[model samples]
Target: MLKVIFLAAFAVGTVLADGELIILNNPGSVHFEGSQATNQSFLKEVFTVVLGYTPKLTQPWDGVEIRDPFLLPEALVSIVIEGVESVKSPRGKHFPLNVDEVEEVTWQAVSRRLEERDTNNTLVRIRVGDGLDALGQSALGELKPNSVDPASLKHLSLNNEEDQKFIEELQLLRAIAQKIPSTVTANSKPDVYWFVVSGLRPVMDLHGKDSEATKEALKLLNDAVNDLSNAFTDIYNGQVVVALFTNDANKLRNTRSVESPRVRREEKAGELETFDAAAQNSSDNLNTIEKSIQKLATDTEGLVEQIVDALETTTQDSEKSTTESDLEERKDDIDSMHSSENDYDPGKPITLRLSKRYSANYPVIFNIFLWFGIVFFFSLLAICIAIAGMDPGRDSIIYRMTSNRMKKDN
Candidate 1:
């Protein structure tokens, strides 16, 4: 499920964010080499899309060869070493070879940043337990690739150490997820990472990958993913994209042993014939690998389309959710504004009118003015009546004048 989601997102070029890629490449043989269950073609196509180039084949297929996706500047690539010819590059990367201090080296690779390094190169980390190597080829052969409870492990009493190592590796992955990126270069490519948890391939395959041990391992992985997803919930999709897929579904041929040359003539001839037969088998294996690569290249386009569709669907869903959330918020605001206090009715017109509640008691100034006018009117009326009733008094000018006139007439 994660493989589908992650591969889909990875194929989409529009959502490239400045994030880091963590690859866990578990080595496993291809179960149905050309069946629909195989993931190699899809993987190759995904890598080609992300990396901007396909892995170049330096030489023909050797039993033991690895290809770096980014083509790091310094890595051992030889034509032939001890009868082993370089395998045709499957347009893929190789697993780490050095077993000594593998943990330290693996962590170093994981933690190394762009600013810390002088050149701008892609980082690939390989991890195999040092203790796993200490068990040597004999014990390693006895135990499964990543099994902690192999019969031999029980006999050797190494269950605890193996379990501890697996736990530590899980811890390491969690740490890598939690760490802040100290160095990010100015690159246009998206930070599509792969975290290859090697060693489990011995127990896993294309169709037969669901073993109890594998399930346990995957459960732990799921836990780690959930933890990280919760931690960065806000930016899980937009910023820190997380997806998982099986890196490959095909298996390389098992390493072949070349016997020493015989001294007897008949033995030597028999040995030559055996070598020829082995060479033919080797040729057939090479053809299988080459055809697989071609198929991968051809089928990549289909995978890309499917992944793109998936990404589009995811995008549409996210956008739809945001829109719904926005509408919900707006509705809430409107509901609050048209509250019970207003006695609002949805069918009523929104027009408004002035309130009739403006009537109130007169102010002190209005009362004082009215009283003064009434009192002045009454006093004037009384004065007029008093003057008329009284005979013309000498104190008044009009009365004095009228008295003088009357006397003259007498």
Candidate 2:
């Protein structure tokens, strides 16, 4: 009997299990180092365009630090260059090429000249005036002279501090770009690569401020940035990308949606309310069964007492036998009810589980759509109100009174 009760209790107890989905937004870090004024201006403009709000510029790199770090996706833009001075290299003798005379010079021609003039590779250095640092080096190695490529051969300018810094910066950019996968699977999106170069006044000033040379240099720089942007787009299959330059920091704010990418919640919160209701129902059923069992036990005890009294009071043999028989039958029924085989099965364990629920704020897209819908509705309502008030053909009381007054004046 005891074993049967224990088995039933175990069967009634339940365990419930649940699962959750976690979403992580990618992590991004921006490093901006340069003139305080220029840096602050650029930072404000970029964050405003990206985040839709201008971040307070308390620290030099305040806005660069990511706000939420838990399971941060990955850095979208790893490097930012703002008004940093270019590196300086030792000055060697300059080799002049008349731009008007030579239509194009190839890498082979320049390399041959360098080899012949300075066999030791000492005192002869080359800096491609254009922003083709990587391409120039590769061409020098692989291309032969007489290729007649306009971009291949140009007069190497004397390296300045700013020029050297620019070269190193390009090197860093290339290295970082190389690490990005050339291709991504359809199911996955590639990480972002963002590079912003602003306020190149000093570099531009290296040439006369308004000179043709300065214009050419600026054009080359723009072309390089475009080339890099296209290359990354092709490699990443056009996952989010922002590569732009601006002379005016203020103009940077005009670019829209530069803000950080967001993570969308893919799953709804767990069904905890349903689980709680089920657990409560099971508890109530268990309590009811327990009370019934206690009542049955008390009733069985009373029946046994009545049978014993009948046996003691009746001296007749037949009456005593009948009472004893009735008592035995009642006891057997109670025993059958308490038997494990008849009352409870121990093979199945009851399980009831309640899980915690989690929820994320609404997605940005949903919020945008919701607000746009609301605004459109309100604007439509306003338009209808205005038309109703101004419509002269309408038979409203105000319009009718106005018409009568106008007729009277006429």
Candidate 3:
């Protein structure tokens, strides 16, 4: 089965599996190198179960931490573009289109340019970016959408990372839907699964430390997140599992650590102290056992005396004399027991007894087979006898073949 590519915002590199794994990594947090991109990050378990692989994330072109890409049994294509900003609004429209526009165009180019080794191969494109504090919530009237086209996200100068991302994802999903044919042909092209990850680095870059700007970005980013959520729901309606995870480290740059309420457990002495006391008491038991050993020794001496007395009593009870008559009476018994007629002497050779021999009876099925064979033989003999009594007609083919008159006539 053709599988979809996963899009996850990776400050470094990440192991994301299946088209269903859509990770919105590092929305408004740090970029370039962050926790979300690590091998042990939030997406690790996600990759392990869904991607049918153990996650081993690494920095692009770095030798040290790269795991899954090298260890995975299947072949995978890895693409990395260095020093590319996810979203940045230029001064007074530097060229023509904005970041979102370029991203959409890039999708088209990637789809068309990657010449498939198999003509039926459909390309799956993944786009990843960080969110701007989150995204602008359009419903709250915080930010207005410029247009429904791809430019809608780009023109926002307000780079709501998720808005731009959702717009892009929606566009790609539609494209893939269009590429799919209603009636499956003998040779059908694989539908493309476009993955998108959007981040709010643009909002940070555009307006730094401005409270008003930050507030504006929050509104826009909120909307974008909602849009992304709605998009996920739409995708999930087709029976796809959509999961959302907030990375612990990516939530903020710096914050004071709060004292954990569970600290009391750590401070208290462990229940192991009771076990230790019991162990000490067990060691003390050796001394008590040693004290009892003296008493046990006395009991042992008494037991030995009783055993000796029992032996002497039995010896006295068995004291008796054998008579010459008794010997003579036993002589006959002894002779009978060792009689040569019995063939039980040590000088005699050993003999082995033979068991009876018998053949196995035929099974019921075999008996039936035997009866069938007899009936068949008799039936054939009767048929032969009946044929032998028949006279063939002169017009019959058998008579014509056997007659010399036919040859002569011919």
| RMSD from true fold, candidate 2 | 25.3
Candidate closest to the true structure, highest TM-score = 3
Of models 1 and 3, which has the larger lDDT? 1
Q: How accurate is candidate 2 locally (lDDT)?
A: 0.39
lDDT of 3 by residue, 1-410 (tens): 12222122331233231111123321111111223322222232332223233323333311113233322211111111111222211111111111112233434533443343244443444443322222232111122233454333333442555345544433333332332332212122223334443334434454563445544444454344445434433433322222232222222212212333345554454556777887788777756655565556566556556655565555566474455465546555544543433333433457789886644444556789999999999999999997787677886657978898888999
Q: Which parts of model 2 have CA positions greater than 4 angstroms off?
A: 1-81, 84-156, 171-179, 182-192, 196-199, 247-410
lDDT of 3: 0.37
> How displaced is residue 104 in candidate 1, in Å?
18
Q: Which run of 10 residues does model 3 get worst, by summed lDDT?
A: 90-99
- Using Cα atoms with residue i matched to residue i, what is each candidate's TM-score against the true structure? 0.27, 0.26, 0.28
Candidate 2 lDDT over 1-410, as tens digits, reads 99798445433321110110011111232222221122323332333323223233444432234443232321122122233222111111111111111111222332343344335431112232333454344312321112123343142132565544444444433433443344222123223333434324555657555656445444545444444444555553443223231222222333222421211121212356667888889889877776776777677668767856776676466544455666678667756765533354333588779686544434556789999999999999999898777756657656776786778988
Query: Using lDDT as the measure, which candidate wins?
Result: 2
